[model samples]
Target: MTKPAVDLIIVGSIGIDDIETPAEKREGLLGGSVSYACAAASFFSHTGMVGVVGTDFPQEFRDTWSSMNIDLEGLQTVEGKTFSWGGKYHDNMDSRDTLFTDLGVFETFSPELPENYKEAPYLFLGNIHPALQLHVLEQVREPKFVLIDTMDLWINIAKEDLEKVISKCTMLTLNEYEAQLFTGEHSLTKAAKKLFDLGTEYVLIKKGGNGSMLFTKEDTFLLHAYPLDHFKDPTGAGDTFAGGLMGALCASGKTDKESIRQAMVYGSITASFGVEEFSLERLTKLDRDQIEIRVAEFKDMCKI
Candidate 1:
């Protein structure tokens, strides 16, 4: 079969997440790197997913992605148990305590890109094994831009391998803490310098609620978060932000710094919706008009 082309290819984790909020315990649902990426990207482009799940992964979830027009041809369903995670959010909601992780089929999984997927112009490599992200990058025959997201866990445990992947990506996105840890610098400017020196042209440091900063060797841009009155869940805000940011970039048909900056604005707006409703509920319901309204509001709020 000749598969249709896509605007973006997302490579990362896909698993079942058991979430606990202060009010209740939520049973397993679909989640992980590519899940958030797929959800956000599906809104703006022809998106495809690549990840490993196990036999226990729901068929309905697969059907949902197909229904939404996301290509899941690269999704691998293995013989063992599905990847599972259990975590409880603290009272503050910004932090969480991980209770369990059974890697299941993901432990020894390897990504095999579909024949046609190798030509995607843009790629988002969600947080996963550093070595694996690099492997995917190595296989891309014509990638125009590659964005990578990583965590403190990998920076702390696999620094060298992580460095290799960081050096290869066009842009690297991380939270404030992870950026500081990666560079051993307390100041965000200094940390970004270190990252830019590592061969990444753009380094985005995300400060929760305080907003995000984008830095290059010669330029720096700061974006304020769109304020919200009610906060429900933050489990996937960063991933949602990436989705909005990158998805918009794909929509813009450009890869310059200004396009990336606009992407950040869209990302922050998308994340505001993400925190309002749990999982993908809020994001899924938001259409282009709704997002444009929020983007205008965000721009006005950030005005000098």
Candidate 2:
């Protein structure tokens, strides 16, 4: 008997982290693009994760993903240590500095999708090397929609390869700094326009704390982040947002503009929960009731 294809497949990094804020420090926390993305996506859709870990990767983390019903048929474990990142966030919670990044098993991570995952209608290529993103895209069948996320490092390093990946994706997600750096446009409108020329159907620019904006050939939509006073850590926020957007889109079974817009709102609302605690602490405990209530608040904020 053949297995069923999941609603979405997320391929990216899985790691351990040491994070510090002005008030406290936490270590040995589960932190990775796939870890957060898969968790967020699982709320609205059947999600699958494809990534590489090491022998040292914790069984607890694996158990967490399993509890979320995320398909792990594509997860590979090898001999090295799991990837580990260390960062320190400033007092204002706006900017941070990277202390270190030990790419143990992640250095050579090349995602291989399971046969069931190849038929997923939605695919989120998380912030990984552009070359690897393209490799995953190749394995999947004709995807109905593909959303790719990236960082400033790729714009500075593997730009040509990154652009190739951008040309093939349905949407691209980037933060404000990366948008300017990638397009050489001070104005976000122009930056998104420049990216449109690269062949992506939509461009979503994430503005930390402030909000996010979505741009397409025909229109643009800007959304404010959910107002939250109890914020703790911002780690994995972007990945969580991407996961929410793609998962909501898949669950809706529509790739139209209006569907994409609604999905963005869900993305922002779900991500807001992640920042309320360290790592996935807040996200794992979240349920549909909390999300729906926040969605109501989001609608009230927009008056829509």
Candidate 3:
């Protein structure tokens, strides 16, 4: 397959987040699924983001993403305030409470891909309404691989639409709870199989601190989460992970099993950095050398 101009195209939310962790509280930080994912993916390839932001979106935020080498052609600037989310993480960082969510411009978001982005070989459909995800799928050209991310909200309220979205994607990424919710199966293995039966070629079940599991018809791979002594924020880790996975794949220009495994490692490594600081602070300061060194350390730690 010929490579498209853009290595990866991501469609999802773009907004500011108000986060309160056990250690600190910060308001109005640049966030959203597209923000985190594009940041991670930018490390490995030419990445572009498609999302809507309101007039209130900061100019600095736009410049930051531009500096990251992300194309913002598909990022629409509309009126009103950008979407905002507020959440507080517990001491353990395992559970969080939603303080408030103001959808704002995101509530009316309708993705419209730029002409140049329509043929991108790799596409990541971020967690959004199932109908919106489906709309994106229809707009894109024949993507070499399509990955979809989902949260529990869509599972409970839009199972049928979510199922339709699942059937169209090449892979699905969701937390373990979402896996069980979708299949009504307690077993991860069973849940994965059920997802594959739904037409997705692969299923990735994220276990948060424990790790992640990748399931395909012929194989199952389990990876441990990269260890961190202190975690400042857990928000957007999943989106960061997804970005790394897709970024690595785009960089390698391969979708083989070995490539996928390496992508998972990259994903875990990126996520470890995400939780070390709030929002994009750590990620923005990171360089390729830091990421490679950490990935090597991870390989050594996992080596038997």
Candidate 4:
């Protein structure tokens, strides 16, 4: 079999974000599920992105991604305003208020993968409409691994479609509340089991600040968040986590339980860098050495 042109393909939103945290406020920063995910994943593997943006999208942003070697052949530039979102974070930084969300081109986004991306070895379905996620899946030739991230909005409104998407994915990632709401079970273990019945091989439950849990039929792995002295903004942390996890998995070319656990640690470390600044500011400047040092520190802290 021929090797894929890219190690990973990400299908999701690309947007500009206006953020207001307790400590500061910033507007029109580069932000989106695929943006963060692709950025994090690029540190580990060859990554491609598929998402729609408007003519108003900055050319400099495009240059930055291109410099990172991210394949943007799948990025569609239409004739409208790019998707924009505004949020205000609380002091704790674990929760936020959606000040506004202008879907713009994203509202009508129909991801169309480029011919070269059709054979990507790994795929990540970002938090987009379930129908669109399924559409992208149909276009892909064959993926060695597939993971998806979803939000509460889709769960409440388009659950039937969401479940169909879940059934086809190798892994599902969502917050703790979304997991409980989807399964109607207060215990995460039961919720994970319920999700397994939905046909996904693994379920990752994200707990902001606290940590994350990975569940498979045979084992469960718990990982703690890397402690930070201060947090600047929480925007894109979850997507960054997903990117790092998928990036590590793709780079290592492994999908076993041990590989998944190691990927989670990489995810956690990358996410800690995300919260240190707004948007992808800190993450863009990171190198493998910085990531390796942090991961080593985490191992030391958690050693038995």
- For each candidate, the alpha-carbon lDDT, in order, equals 0.85, 0.92, 0.92, 0.92
* TM-score to true structure, per model: 0.95, 0.98, 0.98, 0.98
Q: What tens digits encode model 2's per-residue C-alpha lDDT throughout 1-304?
A: 3445788999999989999999889999999999999999889999999999999988998998998888899899989999999999999988999999999989988788888888888999999999999999999888899999999999999999999999999999999999999999999999999999999999999998888999999889988999987888999998998898898999999999999999998989999999999999998899878988999988987883
lDDT of 3 at 278: 91
Please give the distance, in angstroms, between residue 108's alpha carbon in candidate 1 and its true position after superposition. 1.3
Best by TM-score: 4
Give me the overall lDDT of model 4.
0.92
Candidate 2, superposed: residue stretches over 4 Å from native = 1-4
* Candidate 1 TM-score to native: 0.95
How well is each residue in 79-118 modelled by candidate 1, as lDDT tens digits? 9988888889998787899999999999988988887888
What is the lDDT, from 0 to 100, of the residue 127 in candidate 1?
92
Q: Which of candidates 1 and 3 is the stronger one according to TM-score?
A: 3
Error at 166, model 2, angstroms: 0.7
